[model samples]
Target: MSHAPDLGSSAAPGAGAGQREGLGELFSSVTEDLSTLVRQEIALAKAEATQSGKRAGKGAGLLAGAGVSGHFVLLFLSVAAWWGLGEVIGRGWSALVVAAVWAVVAAVLAVRGRSELRAVRGLPDTTSTLQKVPSALKGHEEENHR
Candidate 1:
């Protein structure tokens, strides 16, 4: 059941002087418990969101870094190929082969990254909180073993 914050704090009960102190203590305890519960829920939300963000960030960083590094590698390879071709096959054929190879590399990385990206897309990463709950309760190290 959803907590009605106001209901728990106000409109409970208070009697005469003796009961007043007792009631105040009771209310204070309840309030503390409620506050702790709410804080825990909020912390869980933040932790889960952070985890989901890191997952995407890592994936994106890898994809972008690999994409750039792959392109650079291709550039160097093409230059080397062109230089070699110029010595043997001449400029025109070297340019054509380099362009063709570059196109092939681009298409391959696009296809691969697109496929990997699709896996992570549209996942309700927020609900990952549910999965994390058990682990979060168990402590971080214990969670990893599980």
Candidate 2:
């Protein structure tokens, strides 16, 4: 969290009454501020992720279109090869056999991509850092008391 101006003093802006706040009040204020800060941080991260996701989606769509264009190039080459093979095999059977092989390759690639996507995890480092915060604060407090 960023450095914030002291909130314990009654002289601070938005302070009510002409008396200093107690320790409990100070702790409450700090906790409330921390909660607010965390909420804001989460909101910012979510907004960033949403924007990044939009950009990634657009990029993926463009890539898919490119892949289709490349596939057509390959398809033409495959057709030419199939016509050559048609000299030994029947023309209709040659086309069907090539189509079947292409279908199998596409299915395998699609399944692998799905599995790779599923294997990915999010926010691993952030989660570990957040888990350590309380222990880190406790050490700081112990040092302060000593």
Per-residue lDDT for 52-91 in model 2, tens only? 5665565555456545645754785578576867676567
CA RMSD of each candidate after superposition: 12.9, 13.2
lDDT of candidates 1 onward, in order: 0.62, 0.58
TM-score of each: 0.45, 0.42
Could you give candidate 1's per-residue lDDT for residues 106-146 as a string of tens digits?
66665665556555543354454455655654456356334
Candidate 1 overall Cα lDDT vs. reference?
0.62
lDDT of 2 at 62: 49
Off by over 4 Å in 2: 1-21, 80-146
